[model samples]
Target: MSTSRRTPVTTGLVTALVGFTSSFAVVLAGLRAVGASDTEAASGLLVLCVTQAVGMIVLSWRYRLPITLAWSTPGAAMLAGAAATDGGWPAAVGAFVVTGLLVLATAGWPALGRLVARIPQPVAHAMLAGVLLPLCVAPVRALVTSPWLVAPVVLTWLVLLRRAPRWAVPAAFAMTMVVVGIWLARHGDALDGPLLPHLALTAPTLEWQAVVGIALPLYVVTMAAQNVPGVAVMASYGFTVPWRAAMATTGIGTVVGAPGGGHAINLAAITAAMTAGPEAGPERERRWIAAQTAGWAYLVIALGSTALATVVVAAPAGVVEAVAGLALIGTLGAALHGAVTAEGPREPAVVTFVVAASGVAVAGIGAAFWALVAGVVVHAVVVRRASGADAADEDAATSPSPTPGR
Candidate 1:
């Protein structure tokens, strides 16, 4: 009896660990990239994990949807590449709250969904690509500096990418663990203190920079990259997602957790494939059970975040960054393709991409917001200029060309 229960429980728990471990470095790198201290970043991770777990459990049980929730990985990537805006982490928290409110507003008014949907895809894709471009260089740089250490992890990711593409990042993380373990054992260093929950909060303050730079962009990426695709993933699995309530659950969860350093939470984009699949269970109706188990499992991760935080700090910087960079390799490629492939907005998208990658800040706002603004203006200007040129050429071809013959 015990073995039977333990078997399913273990599967669910392993899924959660995989989920958490696969993305935690991205989250940590993002918080630090956005001006969070180490303690603050760890606190954010713990709060985000716990809050997402709560949202997942409640929404899954209440609606009986296999709702798997996650932090905005793209949003975190944006933060990782972003320059700090006014009020730093506190303002970022403030933006987080605004983002939560915006998400809730979408739930309240379905029209907002349509409005959000109108954001030009090329621009969105460009913004993400720009944001991710800087941080994705870490693995390459690490290879230059610590080839022996970083190569094994990168090689592991490459090998797994061929056979088990889904497991590639986690596999890289595993290889990193083995290398770091050996390094630690040889050095005689140990993680200090018992693993447990700890709280760190940044007092929220509304600032224009945070609202425009952090909140708006954060909301955009979460919706575009995570929630929208996540809903599609659920639909593909033949599940009916109560989209409004699902948005509300994630939004409200973010609101509650943001003051304590958590970033936004939303429906899982990637992990939904795991929890909503045949591997989760044989019966479709029973897959919510897997989601339930995942929730409890995430809570376990929350509890151990302090120790995890210690491990991250104690390890070499390249170690964490190499894995994070490897994890984002696929995302960065997709973003680049999506941003530039479209004919209409290609010029503007490149403008956006360059501004964002350059990491310039203006008027207390980060490069991301400015990048969007710059792209839009440039796109409009170029389009209008091209239209004028086309009109002039048509006039010349139609009427004035006879002078050349004379």
Candidate 2:
């Protein structure tokens, strides 16, 4: 193939490679945190991959835009922090289903999408920052607890972070594989049973807490952090994504994958830049080929989900988590910056951050949902006071009070 054609294919493959390798650990960890068994987590991984791949292919082909899709990394992080619900794994699955439905609703109802857009940016960022805090700190705690195992991973990450930068997380993951292999070699019979992909579906059962705690938060984070940014990224590259169609595709994918352990899928944000930008070749019209290539690449990656899950299952407790933590540090920094930088909502954002980071779950609802509540409440009060003050000042400025002095 000519370089023009070959460039997008290679870029697309890289998009898939980087997207999958960098965050799949977090996805597994997130699924496990929400009460999925090892087999279930592996199943989630498989379905997440397959569904996203299919979504990307369909969207890119149908629209002829580089409309890539991804599993919700932020949503996964939120899940990692969330405790199991009263209904257990089934409830989590139910939350996933609800989240998918909400996404579908957003596509069907413009008002719903508008409501999501109305969420204060600082508050949204704060909630994500808080959800990510516990996971991002894992490397530090892991280093203290298991220095020998985690040190190499951290060092590799640091080195690559300064050098290649984009490959840092994936490289750290590679180091983790090395460390896991060595540890496994040292202790024979660590891994048992087949390491092959398979599905493990569970019938979903909804609980109010899980719906409020998990589904609501998942939908918000996926929308705010992934889908919205994804649309912007494509636009920046001179392509307007079909927002409703994209949401419909991802919502259906999420629902189909839910019973089998997947959390949620949405448009690709960071990876979208790679596939849609000049890196995919200077020809804007042809960049959709990159997304198509990425779809196929994700399918290829899916074949190894079970094997990777087995490794995660067998690795030393802190090792895989350490890699996951390393992958998220950049995201955590971005979230923090976004959370505190808004002038109008800074205090409310801080309040949200404190509450979220506190990890306080009230009445069985997770901290993320409560964080938004606190932020919005504080925001409303603050905005109201500010508006009242503005009104008073305006009245004073225009009033006849100075007539007495005159």
State which candidate has the highest lDDT: 2
Question: Can you give the lDDT of residue 254 in candidate 2?
Answer: 98
Candidate 2: 10-residue stretch with minimal lDDT: 187-196
Worst 10 residues of 1 by lDDT: 1-10
Model 1 over residues 62-83: C-alpha lDDT tens digits?
9876788988889999888776
lDDT of model 1 at position 47: 93
lDDT of each: 0.85, 0.93
User: Looking at candidate 2, what is the lDDT of residue 308?
Assistant: 91
Error of 1 at 398 (Å): 12
Expressed as tens digits, the lDDT of each residue in 13-44 for candidate 2 is: 99999999899999999999889999999999
List clash counts for every candidate, in order: 0, 0
